[model samples]
Target: MAKLIFVNLPVADIAASTAFYEQIGATKNAMFSDATTSCMVFSDTIHFMLLSHERFRTFTSKAIVDARGMTEVLTCLSEDSRDEIDARIATAIAAGGREDTDAAQDYGFMYGRRLEDLDGHSIDLMWMDVEAAAKAMQPPAN
Candidate 1:
């Protein structure tokens, strides 16, 4: 069986977090969901376990970082195009998430936009065109 990745995030409200993720095109996995947690599936291999604060605490001894004041981790999602990255950020804003950074990055080969979820988790929607990157890496014609 293929290994699956489960990213467990602490949220104040399970339902609200689940709804936010739903708007961003994730679907709930009813097979592994309940009142205390919701399994938000972004893809076949990637699953986000949105757990209530109390439930999340059980898994870690460290205090939960207050994301509003400091970043805990930056979760990045790759897209097929730069427009797709922008659209995802826009959708996140429309869904009540806020832009954590002022502008999208254009590094010649890749582009990205950052946003903070309702619970302040930092997420980056990015597009890295490998062909473009490879071209950029090539030495200029003499």
Candidate 2:
């Protein structure tokens, strides 16, 4: 069996978070979803476990960092094109998510935009030029 990856996030409201994820094209896994956690499937291998803050806290004794005004982590997904990136960002905004930054970055070959989820988790929608990235990784020309 293929290994599965699950990214868990703490949300204040499970229902609202589940709805927001659904709006962005993630499907819920009823088999693992309930009042505390909603298993949102992003792909065959990737899933997001949206857990209520209280439930999430039970996993660790450390305090949960408030993402609203701070950078906890930035989750980036690569897209095939800039248009696809834009559409994802648009859908996120339409679903009550906010833009994390106004700047659109264009690194000659790649372009990206960032948005914040309803819970203020940073997400980046990006289009990377594979060839360009490979070239950039090469040692600089002397």
Candidate 3:
């Protein structure tokens, strides 16, 4: 069986968060979704579980911090190209997300940009040429 990852997030509004993820290319998996929880699939193996604050509290005893006021978690995804990253960022912005253009990371062979969802969860979209990046990381000859 293929390995899979499920990223759980506490959202203020399940519907809004579901819509936001959909606008950014994730599809809601109805099988694992309900009124207070949603399963947003980014790929065959990558999924985001959006849970309401009340629903999320049942799973953990720790206090849920405000993502807007401070950094909680930074999620990064790979893109097919730099153009795709830009397109996704624009789409996210149009869907009520905010882009952190000042956080753009560019290293010639690799580039990335970040955006925050309605709840301020940061998602970074990146593109990289694997071969070029490996070459860039090689030690310089003496």
The prediction achieving the highest lDDT against the true structure is: 3
Each model's C-alpha lDDT? 0.88, 0.88, 0.94
Ranking by lDDT: 3, 2, 1
Tens digits of per-residue lDDT for model 3 on 81-117? Answer: 9999999999999999999746689999999999999
| Model 1 clashing residue pairs (backbone) | none
Q: In candidate 2, where is summed lDDT lowest over 10 consecutive residues? A: 69-78
lDDT of 2 by residue, 1-142 (tens): 9998888899999999899999987899999999999999988988999999989989988888889977777777777899888888899999999877669998978999998889999878889889998998899889
Candidate whose TM-score is highest? 3
lDDT of 1 at 12: 90
RMSD of each predicted structure: 1.7, 1.6, 1.0
For candidate 1, write residues 1-142 as lDDT tens digits: 7898888889999988999999987899999999999999988888989989999999999999888888888888788888877787788889988888658789968998898888999888888879879999999999
Q: TM-score for every candidate vs. truth? A: 0.91, 0.90, 0.96
**Global CA lDDT computed for model 2:** 0.88
